[model samples]
Target: MLFSEAQEAFKKHLIYREMSGETVKGYMKDLRCFNRYMTDVYNGAIYVEDITTDDIEEYMHYLLDERELAPRSRNRYLFSLRSFLNYAVKKQWVEHNVASEVDPVKVMEEKKVALTEEEIDELLATIKHKIVKFSVAFLYYTGMRVNEAHNITFEDIDNERNRLLVNGKGKKQRYIPIAKSLKPHLENYLTNIRGPIDSPYLLATKKTGRLSAGYINYELHRATKELGWDKNVTCHALRRSFATNLLRKRVDVFKISKLLGHSSIKTTTVYLQLNENELQTDIDKL
Candidate 1:
């Protein structure tokens, strides 16, 4: 079977499995270079089933050595190829998935940085725009992704439950309880900052449109420009601050994982990085 034929079948299967369109597109895009390599290096003569472990290793070497791609990026390519070939094996187009046996590039996790409570206050104080301030607050406090915060609607807020509906990655929806401290800020935005806007999005721009992720990121960096933070105050930094603070207060890691819309508790526990107060508290106890 041809690689192109297998590609379309794998894509259809992904769509059938309810994968997001963006995710499907990404998988297909990553495979394009591999397909090109097969055509160019082997003169388009290599059959999909006949492709061997040696062929895969050379491809991995080609990605890291010839292309000089980053490990994280190479891992993505490996993931795409592995998933595709696995699908082909199920269909009997390939006898075995050679790509599945290939190890992907290992991605090293960096030390997570979180904002100080004082630094958070300073950052929020610096944001003079009501909309930007409210947006940043929603991200920092609710532990929502920047896109989730940006695309939130008034209807998504549950006054009775005191939770906000978060549209998370891969089109999953979850509700996170709004903090008591954040409740007033949200109400303030609805009553005063929003100003009877017709736009359904909670964070509307000046023209009464949904705030784009880029615009929110731009405002965040702008606020942090003169603040001299040790780390750049990106959207993820606000999210990190939310998770770390909760962990610092002895909140259940599993609960925090759910609130953050993480599929794995491991992902949420990365924020358990020890702060000065935590280190000192443990040392004193010792």
Candidate 2:
């Protein structure tokens, strides 16, 4: 089949697999770019079976040298191609995914910024919306992604156990211990703020039911701006702060990784941001 035909089929397959609309759109955009390259360079509609690893490798160079795409951006294009070819393989359009044989551009790991505990407190106080305030607090204390915190039901709160049953990425469930500092606020929100809402989610507006991840980040950003702070604080920043604060308290990285529900400890380390003073303090202790 032609690459363009296979591209359309792959798009439908992505949607069928329940990928988000934005994600599917991005994949299609990348695939369309690849198809355009094939059409221009190969001089016609190219069959998927005729494409080889060398062709994909050459395309990577085109993205880098000709298109001047950054390694990270170029890698995204390669990733999109890899996903498409993988789908094509599953559909028996190709014997193998040649795109997989091509190496992605190396990207430097950019350290994520985390808010200090004091900054978190000030930001939470700045948020006027009760739901948004509680959402920020929940993310900071629980180290949950915005979606995971939004998905938390009343049943997920095991108050008797002093921990929460969190449904994390990929439908995986884990328990996170509630900090003593957060318990009072959680209780107040549950008793006074969220009591009237009939929604199952712990974080919900009475009219809208469950709050969206975008809304959560928007409120957090607004709160940060209100504080006259120039930091790029978001819901994910709150989560990073949680990990960083725990590390400051000398918690084991492995334990923190489990609490954050990260698939790898290495992923959890990316969330931790300790300043030079903290590093020196640790070194001094030794």
Candidate 3:
């Protein structure tokens, strides 16, 4: 089948598997880029039968050399293409799963960047925009992922119980406790700043409905750049900083895991590694 034909089949498979819209879009974009590369660079049209392991290798190089994509991003594009090829193989559209035969790219282990307490304070203090400051503070205190923070609604806040109902990854529902220290700020952001009960979201654009994850990330990025921070700060970094700081404060790992709404304690174990130096110091004292 032609590249377009293969793409349509992949889209059908994604839809059948109930993949999210964003996921589907990413897969489609990656595959199309591959198709374009074949046509433009090699002057060769790609068919399901024409796809080879060599082509897959060349595509990886193209992503790095031509597209200048980061290792992590290149891996994600490779993953999307591999999934499509796997689907095509199962459907008998391709002779073999060329992606499986291709050697996988090695992803380097990068250290997690957690903000120090002083740095965190500086970042917070640097935020002159009240709304943005509170948003950052909420993430710092709640240890919520960017998407989770954006998912917050007025109704989600259980003031009496001091908890937040969050729809987390995989559409899983969990309750995250709000620190007593954050209650006043949360109330102020809601009543004074957020304004209007027409929308269910705690944070909404004046013209639109709920704030998107992209919007939150963009604001954080702009603020971080303006502050001249050496390290690239992201919205998710706030969540990581919260977890790392809590671990530094000697908070129970299990409790921290629950507050972060991590399905497994293993997911929260990265913070333990972050504290390895401190952990060794404590051990030496003992």
Q: Which one is best on TM-score?
A: 3
Cand. 2 Cα-lDDT: 0.87
- The 10-residue segment with the lowest total lDDT in model 2: 14-23
- Cand. 1 Cα-lDDT: 0.83
> Each model's TM-score, in the order given?
0.81, 0.76, 0.84
Which of candidates 2 and 3 is the stronger one according to lDDT? 2
Query: Candidate 3 deviates by what RMSD?
Result: 2.9
Task: Give lDDT tens digits, candidate 1, residues 129-204.
Answer: 7888888888889988877787788789898988888888878999988898898888898788888666888889
RMSD of each: 3.2, 4.5, 2.9
Model 1 misplacement above 4 A: 36-47, 50-68, 128-130, 169-172, 195-198, 206-208
Task: Please write out the lDDT profile of model 3 over residues 80-101, one tens digit for every residue.
Answer: 7778888888889877788887
The TM-score of predicted model 2 comes to: 0.76
Name the 10 consecutive residues with the lowest summed lDDT in model 1. Answer: 224-233
lDDT for model 3: 0.80
Quote the lDDT for 99 in model 3: 83
Q: How much is the lDDT of residue 36 in candidate 2?
A: 91
Tens digits of lDDT, candidate 2, 129-235: 89788888888888998778878898998878988999776567899888998888898898888867778888888788888889877887788788888778888
- 55 in model 2: Cα distance from truth in Å? 9.4
